[model samples]
Target chain A: MTIREIGDLLDARVLCGKDLDVDVKSACGSDMMSDVLAFVKHRAALLTGLVNPQVIRTAEMMDMLCVVFVRDKTPTIDMIELAEESGIAVLATSKRMYEACGILYANGLKGNGELHG
Target chain B: MGESLAFHYEVDGGDFTSAGQASVKIKKNLRQLGVDAETIRRVSIAMYEGEINMVIHANGGNADVIVDDTGVTIILADKGPGIADTEKAMEEGYSTAPDNVRSLGFGAGMGLPNMKRYTDDMKIESVLGEGTTITMKVNF
Candidate 1:
């Protein structure tokens, strides 16, 4: 799905990179930045409830096209600016983590898949 | 473009919010040099984890990124209290970070392991009373 479509489905507000139309095929939801760093692969959207500059930094490092904040959490001005600087689309949704992941998954966006040993 | 290029930055342990600035800069630098995306991601993630560890534990330190034909090398040095047990520390799910850090979405005890997971090679040198230095490499 396109990033714009994901936002539409999630009823999210586009905070930055509003024009980005990157395609997102997979996503991972977690409050732990380390897990995201350890597991996520390929270019995908990151669904996280955690709010910190590191969140944006994590997305940027993974070359993620977008970061969707679950549960209506507001990102700090620093985060918005960093996302803008990194050219990553930022979205905020009132939907909780599970619901958000489910919504995206039900609509064709799926997880990166099982971890390998 | 050069055979070997080095970038250095001083991490400010005073602020948790600003911990990964050096890693961000390194990511941008590698991108500008036309490094491959996967390699860039590996190097930056490992370095970013190291940067966070330094701030959360050592109160700040120095980070250096050296890029060459074979790979990228990251050297992180800090003067914080050294890890008591390297073996245990390297194990996943082992952490000494305070509770407040976890509230900020870190201190998951995955920092060192994640660093090793993403990099091609990792070495840690620490003097309990003195400090610690970690060197990680990622091939291009």
Candidate 2:
């Protein structure tokens, strides 16, 4: 799914990279940055509730395209600036992590399983 | 690149907000050097983990990324409380970071393991009361 589609589906506010039209192959919902680093091998979108600069850094390390802040969580100005500098699109949604993941998954954005085949 | 290039940075442990600065800069450097995306990602992830570890456990450290003909090598050294058991420390889900770090989205004990998983080679050396130095390599 494209970043715009993700924002539309989740009713999220595009925090940064408003003009970005990138396509994300997968999505991972986790507050644990290590799991995202250790497991996710594809270019995916991270849906996390944890609000910190490291979230942006983790996504930057993984070369992720977008970060969807779940549970109505808002990142600090530092994080927004970091995301802008990294060219990563940021989104904030009121949906909880589970529901956010479920909505994205059901809409054809699968997980790492796509990499196997 | 025929000549080896090295980038060094001092990780400021005083501020948790600035932990991964080195990694981010390294990522940009690698990109400018025309390193492949996957290799850059791996190198960035490993270095980021090491940087975070230094800040959370070592109270800050120095990070060096050396890119040469063979590949990239990252060395992180810090003068802080050293790990008593390297074996246990390598295990996933084992962390000594304080609870406050956990609230910041890390300290779940996945740092070292993630570094090892992403890098092509990894080595850890430390003294009980002295400090720890981690060296990791990623090949092209």
Candidate 3:
């Protein structure tokens, strides 16, 4: 699905990268950047409640297309600028982490695969 | 790239937030060189993890990245307390980092494992109370 569809499905607010929202696909939800790094496949969007520059850096390193902050956790200006520079979109959703992930999952977004044992 | 280009970076151990700067540069450089997306991702992730470890445990270090027609090789060297148990250190969820470091979202004990996961070959050379050096290679 496109990032616009993801935003509509999750009730998310786009915080940055307004121009490229429609170009993204795939999504993964997690607060742990390491876990996200370990498991993210070609997933384009990350659903995270964590707010740190590392979150943006993690998305950049993983080649993710965007990040969604759950529960209305706002990203700092530095984070937004970093996302902008890295070319990853940032969004915020009012839904809690679990519900946001559920909505995306129900709409065909998936985790990279089964978690590593 | 031709002639096996090499890039070197000095990781500042004093600052945690600055840890992944080298990895970011390497990722950018790789992209400019037209390295495949998969290879770039692998190199960046592994180097980022290693860079984090250096800041948290060793204080800081130096990273050297060599890119060639075959693959990419990364060397991280630090003058920090060496790894005591290589086997235990490699275990997932096993960490020697302090609690404060965990608050920063690291110290998850995933660094070493993630490093190994992303690289085709990894070697750890460490001496207690002295320093440590890690060499990892990712083939295209």
Candidate 4:
């Protein structure tokens, strides 16, 4: 799915990088940034309820195309600016984490599979 | 490759909000310096994890990124309480962070592991009470 589609599916508001129109194959939902770094692969949009600069940094380090904040969490101006600087799209949604993940999964965004050493 | 390009950042402890700023700056610098995206990503992730560890465990620290023809090295130094056991710290699920740190989406015991996973070379130096320094390298 594209960034645009994911935003629409989640009914999320684009907080930054609204110009981005990239396609993301998979999505991962987690509040833990470490888990995302250690295990996630081939996922583009990070579905998270956690709001912090590290969330944006994690997506940037992993080369993720977008970060979607779930459950109506408010991102500070710092976060929006950082996402803009990193060229990462940011979306905020009222959907809960599980519901957002389900919507994306039902819409055909699946994890690429396990990552091995 | 006439000289090594070096970047220095002093991580401020007690400021959880400012964590990862150095990594972000280094990532941008490397990008503009013409480093490949993949190598930049690896270095960024490695250094980011280090920065998080420094803030969460050490209260704050220093991070340096040195770049040369063959590789990039990140040196993180902190005077916080040193690791009691290197072997246990290296484990995938071993962490000593407090509950507050966990609520912030970190302290999952994957910081060190993630640092090692994304880099080509990694070494940790610690003195039970003195401090800890982590050095990581990612080769082109």
iRMSD, per candidate, in listed order: 1.9, 3.2, 2.4, 1.4
Model 4: which docking level applies?
Answer: medium
**Which of the two, 3 or 4, has more DockQ?**
4
Residue pairs whose backbone atoms clash in candidate 4: B13-B59
User: Residue A63's C-alpha lDDT in candidate 3?
Assistant: 86
Model 2 per-residue lDDT tens digits across residues A1-117:
899999999999999985657788887888888878876547689999999999999998888899999999999998999999988999999999999999999999999723210
True contacts kept of each: 0.78, 0.84, 0.36, 0.73
Best-to-worst order by TM-score is 2, 1, 3, 4
lDDT of 3 by residue, B20-134 (tens): 9999999999999999888999999999999989999999999999998889999999999999999999998999999887767788888999999889999999999999999
i-RMS of candidate 1: 1.9
RMSD values for the candidates in order, in angstroms, are 1.5, 1.9, 1.8, 1.7
Q: How many residue pairs clash in each candidate at the backbone level?
A: 0, 0, 1, 1
Quote model 4's iRMS. Answer: 1.4
lDDT of 3: 0.87
Worst 10 residues of 1 chain A by lDDT: A108-117
List the pairs of residues colliding in candidate 2. none
What is the DockQ for all candidates, taken in turn? 0.69, 0.64, 0.49, 0.72
Looking at model 1, the pairs that clash are none
Error of 4 at A30 (Å): 0.6
Worst 10 residues of 4 chain B by lDDT: B12-21
